[model samples]
Target chain A: MPHISLPDHLPGITGLLEFSQNTAAPIRELTQILLRGDNSLTQGERELIATVVSHNNECRFCTSAHTAAADLLLGESETCEMVKYDLDNAPVSDKMKALLTIAKMVQKSGKSVSPEAITNAKAQGATDIEIHDTVLIAALFCLYNRYVDGLASVTPDDSSFYQYLGERIVNHGYTRLPQGYDHLKNS
Target chain B: MAYIKLPDNAAGMRGLMAFRPHLAPHLGAFTEGILCIEDGLTKAEREIIGTLVSKLNDCQLCEGVHGAVAACYLDDNEVLIEQIKEDYKKAPISDKLKALLNIATSVQKGGKYVSESQIQRARDLGATDIEIHDTVIIAATFCFFNRYLDGLGIDPIQDSEIFRQRGRMIAKGLGYAPKK
Candidate 1:
């Protein structure tokens, strides 16, 4: 049960956003721009960054949601799990590992993302845009994770729900998610 | 002189954003939207939330700069800003604002920290849902900013006058647009 009443059947932030459209607009707009907008990082990589931060923050809803998105785009779930479980042990590239390391630091404290980490990411071929997006993705997810968990929104017991939503997200994206809320209601 | 070499003139978070001009514009726009755009909270109230959260995060640079901005928006209400930082509950502010600040502090701790009672209190004190939402976003965003600036090892300005000047510019709706 959420701390406050949200629209019936809506899960996590979806319910929270539906509760107030005014607050929802900017947040949705920002999410679209950051996650799906033009950037050097692929949608998978960006979603992975979000997943890593969400995991670190211990937000199950966000972690599961973004993990599904990452799984779809990357064509594998193991990569996200690897990044989530242990970045170093994950079989991602040197560059990706470096970026994930920076994301983890951001989850701890923005100040914790050190000069050495940036240097390491750069050395591994992370561009300025990539670095910027990585930070924003990490930062944005913190907001999102807090928004969902803070409200005490319902986390669906079924894992397939996330994967189904993920496929829908990979096709249409955040703007469509709100409309899908109504469809979810009808269904 | 931190993780990345920043321009001498680019101080604090400005310096970090300056390191990447491409993303700088978006951040500038977001700040403008959050603080300058006419919305649920007055510009001064938004600044108050920003300043208070920065103070809570122990981010001197953000607190000082936003305090200057809040001072400008509040018509040089320096004492009020000081009061808010020291103890907003007893501070001589409207109950609505105090309630919003209470919510902001909850955001500062963690999202899960905000309670239904707090929301109900803000609503009871004439705070609309939009106002409460904006306060939470402002507080949460500052956490990101404070951490970003401090994470990058950005330091506060040595001169208070600089903050005053910037505050005036921001108050005049100059916003965070990066100059060419």
Candidate 2:
């Protein structure tokens, strides 16, 4: 059971977000801009970064949700799994590998991210904006992971729910939730 | 000095936010939403939560910055702020605040460390649902801020007076708005 009463139909961050629309507005906007907005990094690549951070944090809901989104965006499922299991040999480019390295370090602790990681990322052609986004994405997921799990929000065990969520995220992005979900709030 | 080439005028997270213009406004709005909006928890209590989380994360910049904000709301009660930082459990705050701070401590350790009993204890002390929710959000958000500033190796400003001045502005409703 969740620590606070939440909508049963919506699970994970979605349900929690619905519970508080005041904070949700800005959080939704920020996530939309970070993951879906115009940038050198593709939406799929940003989703991949979110997946890596969630995976490292052991947040099942976030990991599964973003992994599904990344899979659909990238048009493949194996890469997300491979990145989770062993990023070193994952089929991603060396640049992605370098960026993932920094993301993982940020997951451990901000201080654990060494200067060499930044140097390596730049060497791999990661621009200043790319490096900055990677760090922010990683840090943001930490907040998400903790928020979801700290409240003990609902985490659906059904894989089909994630598949639907994946499609929704890929098509609609993060700003707006599906209609009719409003009635579920405060219920 | 930060590892990245951030703006020279802005300090700490301000410089980082300045580096990326696109994302700064939303982030600022989010900060204002959580900290400035006084619904259940007072603004001072919320800032205390942020200051405590930053201190636990060892982010000196955030601790001092937010600590100053909390102090400003408390009528310059720097001593009380220090007491809360040192140990909110023994501090002269309300039982409700103590319960909330306990939850904040668990959150700083890890997400799952927040036990059901902790929630029960807080609720027992008259903390509403929104209060508990905002506490967790505030604690979690500071983790984001701390890591963002520290991961880039931004140096913390040393002078206490600087934070005091900034605190006055923030308490006066400057909030997290990006500097023009």
Candidate 3:
């Protein structure tokens, strides 16, 4: 399925990361900043964008993982769908929707995100940092989607994988998998 | 015409970077665990993933910055990089990396956008979980960074060589133990 061999059958850059050490630190740093670093957007909001983009990209492993994580931060079902389907129309605060709108534009085209988008986001009380982080989040997801789809990595067979992983990731944070994660080799 | 005031930008990106020198201090150390693998992927590969993702997103700033960064490990073939930006599948890359780019694409769009069959396809091709995990994070994070550049209205530098030089320094670590 993947274009190449992988460590746990997941595709894309993850497989490549396994056998090498020189590149890990930078990659890890980048990932941490993307998911965990403090920014204008909350972790849930950030992960929610990932879920939306993952869904758009049809990257299941990522979708399930982030969706489950979104559930933890937002809630199950309704809020999750809100994050997945309609951030602009979701029940989130106006500032959030404005930020999400700007984020979507970042996904669509950096140029398409008009001045109004930034203005509206700012009027809704989005800070320069918030606006900046929103665009960053969206732009980063585009790169991520390409990476996974480009490599054609394998996703976990279980839908619950993300849910379980989300809990662990949310509690412990990204980069650190649950204990005995290496046992996934047995899966 | 600009979303943010013009005078503020040059100072903003610099000021922000100056303040948050630890862009990913914790994440860098935490994610190193999966650095182990059989296929021999390196940090450069992940950076390429981010760079390619940024390119696809069309953020001239990020594309220029990360593109230059990605070029550090790769041979200095501008056409090849251009080909990758235009279309990775048609570009010159190993079968292994091509698959990773697919996964990264999924991550860029959003995790839910990735389908079950896609995962199966990658696995069928022999993708591993660590690779998958790292790809997800990379994709997810690039989205963050892509937005950061675009949202802040950071203009792409005309001289890409500067970003490339920065990438070289990054390849060797922050050096000063993160001033932040």
Candidate 4:
């Protein structure tokens, strides 16, 4: 069914890291900084950017997962749906809407983000850092959306799964797959 | 009136734990390591790659927040960020950054989008192998991060202050604390 079918459970990037201890530390460190760390964005905002982009790519697993996470963070069902599909309709601050618009532009066309969108977001107080971060998040998500979709990993169709993962991710971090969750054997 | 209502990621994180688990710490370190280079690309240029890619991907979460991250380093200069965000090629940045971003853009589209010529151009502009490698990695990793976040559909934190503080923190080297 998938374009490039991997095993039900593949070793993924984790195994590659383990192959070389020296390489692994630096890889892990970089991963953490990109995902978490301080930026002009919150963890939630970053997640939202991923969700929106994935939605465009139509990566079901990513869409569902991030939607669940979005619901968890903002606490609004209609809003989540709106943000998932048409964020313009979603009730958000003007600045945010403009920013979201710009993000979508980046996703759709890297070279198409309108100067007006930038101006609008900036007018609403979007900073250069915020703008840059937005573009970064959008660009990075494009890769993520492709990678997940490219590799036919098991995309669980369960909101509960996302909810569970979200809480832990927020509390702990994306350090390792959950305990007792081994994919190498299955792969 | 940004829609701020939903069940949130807390409820869905459990399912994610089973499949992907928690790897943020590692990813965090990964990003930092890739970004720690002294003089290849200015912090602004590096963040530009990150911001531009995220923008292309259409990840609202990444866009909303990272836009702020890009802004922080730019001294809230939305215009400059916009120039890059709108059109990196025409943006008021050095040719080197523009070329590197072109390479990064290729990665965002698919490595095939990156050709030997682009790499050569970057090298010609004085990009080190390490810098090139890190740039690719950054692009590649963000792709992962973007999908993971989208897979989860986490709500974006729409607070400017939060990201402003984040910019400061990130500019501060993300500090080193032993992992728990």
Candidate 1: list runs displaced more than 4 Å: A1-6, A15-30, A37-40, A176-181, B5-8, B13-26, B37-40, B176-180
DockQ, candidate 1, comes to 0.41
Residue A66 alpha-carbon offset, candidate 4, angstroms? 1.8
Better of 1 and 2 by lDDT: 2
Cα-based TM-score, every candidate? 0.86, 0.96, 0.64, 0.48
Q: Kindly list the per-residue Cα lDDT of model 1 for residues A1-187, writing each as its tens digit.
A: 7656677778887887777664566666667777898877789988998999888888888888889999999998889998898789897889989888988888877767888998999999987667766876787777777777766778887999898878877888876353456667755
- List candidate 4 segments past 4 Å from native: A1-31, A177-180, A183-187, B1-180
Q: What is candidate 2's TM-score against the reference? A: 0.96
Residue A123 in model 4: lDDT:
90
Which candidate has the top score in lDDT? 2
| Sliding window of 10 residues with minimal summed lDDT for model 4 chain A | A1-10
The top-ranked prediction according to TM-score is 2
Chain A TM-scores of each predicted structure, in the order given, are 0.94, 0.95, 0.84, 0.77
Q: What is the per-residue lDDT of model 2 for residues B1-180, given as tens digits with 9 covering 90 to 100? A: 576789889988778877997888889989998999789999999999999999999999999999999999999999999999998989999999999999998888778889999999999999999999999999999989888989888988999999999999999878886656
Write down the RMSD of all candidates, one decimal each.
Answer: 3.1, 1.8, 6.5, 13.2
lDDT of 1: 0.80
lDDT of 4 by residue, B1-180 (tens): 111122334322222233332433444555655554455666666677777877776655555555666676778876887788899888888888887788777777754356667877877998775466556656766565554444334445567676566566666555222235
Against the native complex, each candidate's DockQ, computed on alpha carbons, is 0.41, 0.81, 0.23, 0.10
Ranking by DockQ: 2, 1, 3, 4
User: Which segments of model 2 are wrong by more than 4 Å?
Assistant: A178-187
The local lDDT score (0 to 100) that residue A125 gets in candidate 4 is: 87
